[model samples]
Target: MLSQPPVWFILIAFIAALGPLVFFHELGHYVVARVFGVGAESFSIGFGREVAGWTDKRGTRWKVGWLPLGGYVKFVGDLNPVSMPGEEKEDLSVEQRRRAFHCRPVWQRFLIVLAGPAANFLLAILIFATFYVAYGRPETPAVIGPVIANSAADHAGLKAGDRIISINGSATRYFQDIQAVTSLRPNYSVDLVYERGSQLRRVPVRLGSEQRLDEFGQKYVVGLLGVRPPQLVYKRLSVFEAVPAACGATANVTKMMVEIIGQIVTGERSPKELGGPLRMAQVAGQRASLGWSDFVYLIALFSINLGFINLLPVPMLDGGHLALYTVEAVQRRPVSLRAQEWAFRSGLAFLLALLIFTTLNDLGSFGLWESVGRLIG
Candidate 1:
């Protein structure tokens, strides 16, 4: 088992990993707004009081804020960094109106808001592609190395050296595919086909259910086949080949994330398993200790996650901005300012509640509450 790092290491790793992501995400919004002729008032790398800043030729203040957790861009004529439209937009001169985000066409505003998440996704793809081109891809064939005793695989007569061909009629090209298929079907019997020394065999295996707990003590019921794979094989690809492969990998991650979210929504999974910054910090620290490659991989995963999260249609997110633009397009008018204010307030509340819940989950994982209980006792 990997040993946990000290608190300082975790904090440093978390900030190092997250800071670049926040910068690029906000950069996307800033660039697009600039392209659309909208002037930005400020480009901040973090929140709270500004620590250092410089004004650009365009009069945009580029600043680093005290808080390094998140960042934002404030466009000209916006009331705040969240891009709430200013009431003074109507009274601005022609030149000022041209530079104002709210005064821009709905489509342009939509694109500007959409750019932030889009940038994060693009960044993930680029990073994955670069890694693939440099290091080649790991191809783990669906060949069984060993079958655990008393496992579903053992009960179903699966043997060492068997190569899995398909699960539940879906052809599996890699060992991960088998995991992907079985994980979603806990306690269900599935038809598994494999090849053993030129002979093909089909077996009905009832996947065993295992209750696993995370570092946070959150429980999960996952299907287990109890088989291990042989050593991984690396396949070198040309730069051109790696791009599409990287895109496919990103898409697969996105699909899996969506499925997990859906499972949580349907009560198939518990929301207690949700993690916050502290959990991320722990994972980041562990990956950093492993090596640079592992750390970069973690960054890529988090980047994709950040993009997907921002695309959710909850108000105050990038997706919510796009959603409002869609409504404006359909209704041939912008949503009322009062309605927008209420919606934003509600979104902020929802986000705060979620943050608090996840933070508590993190603290519990660190045994903070247990320590407190011991002290009280």
Candidate 2:
């Protein structure tokens, strides 16, 4: 059985893991904004009160905050870090107008908002590519070893030695590919292509699912296909091969994020499985204790997730900004400030509710609620 790491280890691991990810995410926005000649008023590494800071020659106040949870970059003439509008259009001098974020063309604004998530995806890709180039991808043939009776595969009329060629029209080149699709789609029916003795077959199978924990105790609600793999093999890639492989890996993780979030929202998965900082800390510590490689891999995984989450179309997210910019692009006019404000308010409320719910989940994960209940009884 895997045991939890020490509290101190978890705290250190969490901070170390989150800090750089936050910096890179903000840096994406900062660099792109700078490229467009938009001046940043402040580049903050953490939220809340400033712990320490310095001004650059460009006059951007670079600061660290007491709260190490997350960070933001405040652009000139922007109301807040979320890039809400603040200053009136008429109040700005020509110079301020030149530096203001809103003054930029809609396409530019869209790219600027998008750069944050893009940076995260880039980080994950680089990391994965490096690993692939050095070590290689773990591969197993997409041939099934056994099909448990009465399971999804059995229901689909699959048997041992059947080679899965594709699922839902996507190529399943390896056993992991089969898993990547199936794991995220519990209770969901999928169209699968498999080959047996030179004959191809198509089947629609409704997956059964089970709750499982990884080595680090990360819980997952994964689809069960009732098919087992044969063994493990590592296929090293050239630099050219690694790059595309890494891109595919990044795309796969993002797809997983979208599917899992959709499942949660639709009640196919319980919201209680949602986690917050504490959950992250525990997992980080476990990975850290294992070694630097594991820790770095966690960083890559979390970075991709950070990027995908920001790209969600909810208000107050990068995706939300992109959504408005998209509206502006199509209409040839900006969304009204009043409408933007309402969206922002709604987004803020939604995010707060999410936070509260996730915190409760985290507490329950730690058995805090159970402990309190015991005391009450």
Cα lDDT, model 1, residue 105: 94
Q: C-alpha displacement of 90 in model 1, angstroms?
A: 2.4
Best by TM-score: 2
All candidates' TM-scores?
A: 0.89, 0.92
* Residue 278, model 1: Cα distance from true site in angstroms: 1.5
lDDT of 2: 0.91
lDDT of 1 by residue, 158-214 (tens): 998999999888677888878887887688799999999999999999999888865
For model 2, state the Cα shift of residue 1 in Å: 2.0
Residue range 1-377, candidate 2, lDDT tens digits: 57788999899999999999999999999999989999999999988999999999999999999889889999988999889889787998999999999899999999888999999999999999999988899778999997888889988889889999998887999999988888877888889999999999998989989889888565667788889886777899999999999999999888878777888888888888789887888888999999999999999999998999899899998999999999999999999999999999999999999888888899898889999999999
The weakest ten consecutive residues by lDDT in model 2 span 213-222
Model 1 clashing-pair count: 0
**Model 1 CA deviation exceeding 4 Å by range:** 156-171, 181-205, 209-222
* lDDT of the candidates, in the order given: 0.88, 0.91
